[model samples]
Target: MNSIEVEHLTKKFGDFIAVNDISFQVKEGEIFGFLGANGAGKTTAIKMMSGLLQPTSGTAMVAGYDVITQSKLIKRNIGYMSQRFSLYNDLTVFENMQLFGTIYKIPRRELKDRIMDSLARLDMTKQANLLVNSIPLGWKQKLAFATAILHKPKIVFLDEPTSGVDPIVRREFWNLIYETASTGVTILVTTHYMDEAEYCHRISIMADGVIRLLGTPEELKKQVGVNTINDVFVEYVKH
Candidate 1:
């Protein structure tokens, strides 16, 4: 089943088109990567799918809800974590989790158990009382991810989720993403890291507000006659 279906989705700011009639489908439980350089319309496209921005033309169905007509329902069923950390630095780890749970409307009876389970999985139970500002960057990213999915949404949108973290931390973060995907949660992520793009089951590369390349990592390399996704990206996006 396709968890996401986009058809001719376009976004325009007056005469300038940020996303030009782009379309794609993401399979259920798939790690679908949206990759591109800055100003390539990746962010615009993701914002449309997440119901955070309205498209100028066309439509998309995300988590079985229409992007235009059913945007509210779409938002409720999808989790989103932006490039900037979403947690409140003054709040404790558990407090941030609690706040997000309430925002998602998780039942009070189940919220505590869910919070505990998530912290345990990350080996972060001990740090639950620590203020978010005091925790390490890597741990904060993990917490942000956990909070995003606290409601067990059908789909999650992660925009540059591991942008500035170290290699080891990024690897650990991807492990969490994989574990989330294992349980049938569809993941749509945007990133500039070529190595991270390779981790995705399939990827779409946007250039000049359109998808210039789309396929699995191996297929893309073979199609472009390149040795790495980095080279493939340069071939299509830089030129």
Candidate 2:
């Protein structure tokens, strides 16, 4: 089954169209890479699908809720993490998780247990009491990802989730993504790192407000007559 279905999804601001009539579907448990250059409308499309923005025209069903009308429901069913680390810097690791879990309305007692479990899974139980700002960049990224999925939302939006982290950490982070998707959570991630894009089950490259290519990594490489996703992006987006 498809966890996200977007058709003719367009976003406009005054005279400019940020995303123009894009369509795609991400299957349940699939890792979908959303690839594009800067100002290529990736963020705009994500905002609309995540219920933070309304599209000017077209339709999207995210986690089975309509993007235009049932946006609230869509918000409740999705989790989001960004490169800038969305968690509170002043809060300790545990506190930040507690805050989000509470916002999701998880009971206090259960939330505590779940937070502990998640921390343990990240091998971050020892760091639970540390202020988020005190942690290293890599750990903070992982913690942010952990906190994003605290409520186990059906879909997770990862925007440049591993951008500044090191190679080893990036591999470890993708492990978390795989583990989550194994249980049927859909992952829609926007990223510039082509190596990370290669890990996606499928990817779409957008340019000038339109998707110029959509396929698996190997398919894209073959179609573009290139050797890597990076080459595909360069060759496809430039045109």
Candidate 3:
């Protein structure tokens, strides 16, 4: 089943078009990458898909709910982690988890078990009580992801989740994303990292409000006759 289906999706702010007539589908349990440079409209497209922004035209269905007609249902079935760190720095990790759980209206019993499971999976159980401000950037990131998926949503939208993070930490984060996708939670992630783009099952490249290319990383690289996605991107830019 398709976890995400977007057809002729477009977004405009005043006279400027941010997302221009893009169409794609992300299969259930798939890791789909949204790749582009700054101002390439990746975030705008993501916001539309997450039901955080209304499209100027076209349609989308996320996790089986129409983005326009059933946005509340879409929001309930999906988890969203933005580029910015979202957890309250003043709150303890445990407190923050509980807060989100409460907001999502998850039962106390299920929330407790889920939080513990998430911490254990990341080997972060020992730091469960630490304030978010006290944790290192990488650990804080892991915690943010854990919190985002605590409710076991059908799909997750990660908008540059590893931006500004260290290489080792970023690699580990991708591993976590793959592991999540393996468990049947489809992931739609936007990234400026070329290497990370290669890890996705499929990717779409955007530029100046339009998707210029869409294909597997291997296929994209071969089409450009480049050895790396970085090189392919350069070729794309020069073309």
Clashing pairs in 1: none
Q: What overall lDDT, based on C-alpha atoms, would model 1 receive against the true structure?
A: 0.94
User: Which pairs clash inside model 2?
Assistant: none
Model 1 CA deviation exceeding 4 Å by range: none
User: Candidate 3: misplaced stretches above 4 Å?
Assistant: none
Model 1 weakest lDDT span, ten residues long: 230-239
Candidate 3: clashing pairs of residues: none
Q: Write the residue-wise lDDT of candidate 1 on 47-75 in tens digits.
A: 99988899999989999999999999998
What's model 2's overall lDDT? 0.94
lDDT of each: 0.94, 0.94, 0.90
Can you write out model 3's per-residue Cα lDDT over 107-133, one digit (the tens) per residue?
999999989888999999998899999
Clashes of 3: 0
Q: After superposition, how far is residue 43 of candidate 2 from its true place, in Å?
A: 0.2
